[model samples]
Target: MAQTDLVPAARAPVLAAERLAVDGQYLTFSLQGEIFGLEILRVREIIGYTQPTEIPLMPAFVHGVINLRGSVVPVIDLAQRLGRGATELKARTCIVIVEVDAADSAQPMGILVDAVDSVLDIGADAIEPAPAFGSGMRAQFIRGMARREQGFIVLLEVGHVFALDELAALARGVETAEAQA
Candidate 1:
């Protein structure tokens, strides 16, 4: 089956509150030797790392954009965005495409990770609230932390991680500064 086929049709839109409270599968991946997960429902597909077309004046974390079956989608460097330093692409590197809620719409975005791991079923009982400190990343970016026999999986809140509104505002500020200059 095609990667697109894995995506569910006619599925109910996931709400922010319900995203972390539900028990379901998570698509885990490795970044800088740490395990990170994203709600599987939000994931559309995964593809091998493809060099993206560079965009000028975008945030350093914004790697660039790619043409996805005709759609120009922005790709983010997950490690850099998390302040863990930029990811050094390897043979195992992959881009996980996900749909993030933005302004009453779902936008397709790609996140570059070190490698794609298995999809694990993480129960609600095994989840804990994001820590107030020492998570290494912004608290809002974390949906929760899940305990596994291997270790803790940092569950990411996709909407917060790829917040289009916040990014747009930041981009606007950059543009305004450039114009003033």
Candidate 2:
């Protein structure tokens, strides 16, 4: 199927809220060695590693685009994007398909994760504002820190992680690369 045929279906579910409580359930996953979470509602699906079609002139962090059914979804290495080095693909590694709400539309993107952990119900009492320092990833990408077990899981702000400006630049890069090719 053509990509335009797939765009609407891909963006529809990402904006709906499925939770009823003030506390949010987060789908946690590992990047490098640290754990991170995305509000469960933001995630669309998880697929095993599939090499994406390389798009030239794109950022080092961008793994390139994937033909998800029919839609061309950009896949990003979460670790590399955050300057933590590239993620080593393993049998357990998966591309987390997420719907990131953008200024013009709800954009569908893929985030490569080392491994997916269990979903945790982190209530408001257990969630704290992101610390100014010490967190491994950029502060802007972090939504908050959830206290769990003996440590913290950085909650990712999906919208910021897959910001439109960054993606638009990547799209431009694709065009530039194609032109030069």
Question: What are the per-model numbers of colliding residue pairs?
Answer: 0, 0
Q: Which ten residues in a row have the lowest lDDT in candidate 1?
A: 8-17
Worst 10 residues of 2 by lDDT: 12-21
Global CA lDDT of candidate 1, please?
Answer: 0.88
What is the TM-score of each predicted model, taking all chains together? Answer: 0.86, 0.80
Scored by lDDT, the top model is 1
- Model 1 per-residue lDDT tens digits across residues 28-135: 999999999999999999999899999877777889999999999999999988987999989999999999887777899999999998999988888877778998
* Residue ranges of candidate 2 with Cα displaced over 4 Å: 1-22, 170-181
lDDT of each prediction vs. the true structure?
A: 0.88, 0.82
Off by over 4 Å in 1: 1-19, 177-181
RMSD of 1: 9.2
Judge candidate 2 at residue 165 and give its lDDT.
90
- lDDT per residue as tens, model 2, 24-78: 7899999777889999999999999999998777788889899999999999999
TM-score computed on alpha carbons, candidate 2: 0.80
